[model samples]
Target: MPEVPQPVNDNTIKVRQLSHYQFSWVAGEPGQNGTYTLQLVLDQGAWEEVLTLTADDADALQDLLVNTSVVHYDVERRTLLFGVTPAGE
Candidate 1:
């Protein structure tokens, strides 16, 4: 029998700081979808996470990053704040 797949959970990680990032693109076979991988090193290199996004999604994120003036990874909120000024203005 084939091995069963495990269920995925909706968990969130608080990011205090990001130390590094890398982007990669893999071409899919004929008639297949390619994927973009965004590798992130968080918490001053304490850990890392890789996110796979579709081409459209990756383009959208790139646009946002290009146009945004500020980006914040709020640890307490556990979310990304784009185009919002950081504290202590």
Candidate 2:
């Protein structure tokens, strides 16, 4: 009998929600390259890099923010929520 080769499989990338700017807006963790980006929807949607955070910045932001449905940035709070996910997604 001839030996058979096993099929190869690709790794699945799981997307976890990191932060929510609003019910209709949210953001995810930066990829391996340390760059945060957003993808828009349209006939030909595109991905845009909105911000780049250092290790310190990421730690600060993570500690200061939480998931919410109100997308606002106040001088008093000194926190900014950039819209990434589309409405009702």
Candidate 3:
């Protein structure tokens, strides 16, 4: 499923996976100081983000989700970058 942009107020945000390939990314609110999280996913199926930034840094996010077929996702953001292809034939 496509990753939805989660919220980060104090420290971190939890990425909810809607499918097998739910790639996620995140950054601080626009002009909201500066704090960023490093996104990583493993084969073991684990997603986590850490607060390694302050409210003074600008951080944008980008993710690549590989789905089994056509995964559906809904996010507050209107636009996003997705790299996908048809599932196995």
Q: Best candidate per TM-score, number? A: 1
lDDT of 2: 0.37
**Relative to the true structure, how large is the alpha-carbon lDDT of every model?**
0.65, 0.37, 0.35
Model 2 regions more than 4 Å off: 1-49, 67-89
Off by over 4 Å in 3: 1-32, 45-81, 87-89
Q: Under the 3 Å rule for N, CA and C atoms, how many clashes does model 2 have?
A: 2
In order, how many clashes per candidate?
0, 2, 7
Model 1, total clashes: 0
Candidate 2: tens digits of C-alpha lDDT, residues 1-89: 97645452221211223323211223545654444322212112221113456556655555555444433332233335444567799
How far off is residue 87 in model 1, in Å?
4.3
Each model's TM-score, in the order given? 0.58, 0.27, 0.21
**On a 0 to 100 scale, what is the lDDT of residue 6 in model 3?**
71
Output the number of the lDDT-best candidate. Answer: 1
Instruction: Please state the error at residue 67 of candidate 1 in Å.
Output: 4.3
Worst 10 residues of 2 by lDDT: 40-49
